[model samples]
Target: TILLGITKASLATDSFLSAASFQETARVLTDAAIEGKQDSLAGLKENVIIGKLIPAATGLPRYRQLTVAVEGYKAREVDELDIAAS
Candidate 1:
């Protein structure tokens, strides 16, 4: 039971930043550096640490490749939009 708890805590996060704030500061950083580890956005804490919103049920990074083509509508720059709005 004790071993299970230990394993659970260790496996909860592989983030060096999180671990650094936790117990094994040097060991975690050393292991990560020696292994040439790059931080990933695969975990919730990583996203939170970087100030990024979590991916909701919307399954978004939404609108990244969104390009709208309107028939008979000429697309103008943002500056033009301000002038036109005025």
Candidate 2:
């Protein structure tokens, strides 16, 4: 049936996306290890392996970016900046 075919296609697409995500994460971790840099961003597996907080249902401090407040400066809206042409 057409419905079954659609379901199969959806499952295959989900599997492919999952595999690609895993591959990318693995590549990043490998590169970090080679460079002797510690990946402080903890995820499920990493937290479990290190026996720390799993970043869920915890009162941990969230990551924040340091921003500087500029005065008397008008920022231009650049919604269509093309980097490829530069």
Candidate 3:
């Protein structure tokens, strides 16, 4: 999706997965994991998340600009969130 969006300014692949999709897919995959199915479903999920889905979902021009603008805010928030634990 990121490649598509960058190359063509649009997505070519379907990215209809949502919270419900995650829950359902995770439920099934967890069952598979428990049964020792040994497929790379977890890896597939991670690849989808980090490789394509997250960037596309948050990579719109406006959000990209906002991300640049608010990066410090986020960093400060993260520092605050982690300070107590650390």
Candidate 3 lDDT, 30-53, residue by residue in tens: 655576653232333444554432
Q: What's the candidate order when arranged by decreasing lDDT? A: 1, 2, 3
**Candidates' TM-scores?**
0.45, 0.29, 0.21
Lowest summed lDDT across 10 adjacent residues in model 2 is found at 77-86
lDDT of 2 by residue, 1-86 (tens): 45545444443332333222444556555655676765454455455454555565431434122234579877543221221122
lDDT string for model 1 (1-86, tens) is 34456644864575766655556778778988999988766656565566555444322356333446899999654432342244
Residue 5 miss distance in model 1 (angstroms): 1.8
Q: List candidate 3 segments past 4 Å from native.
A: 1-23, 40-46, 50-86
Weakest 10 consecutive residues, lDDT, candidate 1?
Answer: 77-86
- How are the candidates ranked when ordered by TM-score, highest leading? 1, 2, 3
Candidate 3 or 1, higher lDDT: 1
Clash pairs, candidate 2, are none
| The best candidate in terms of TM-score | 1
Q: Return the clash pairs for model 3, or none.
A: none
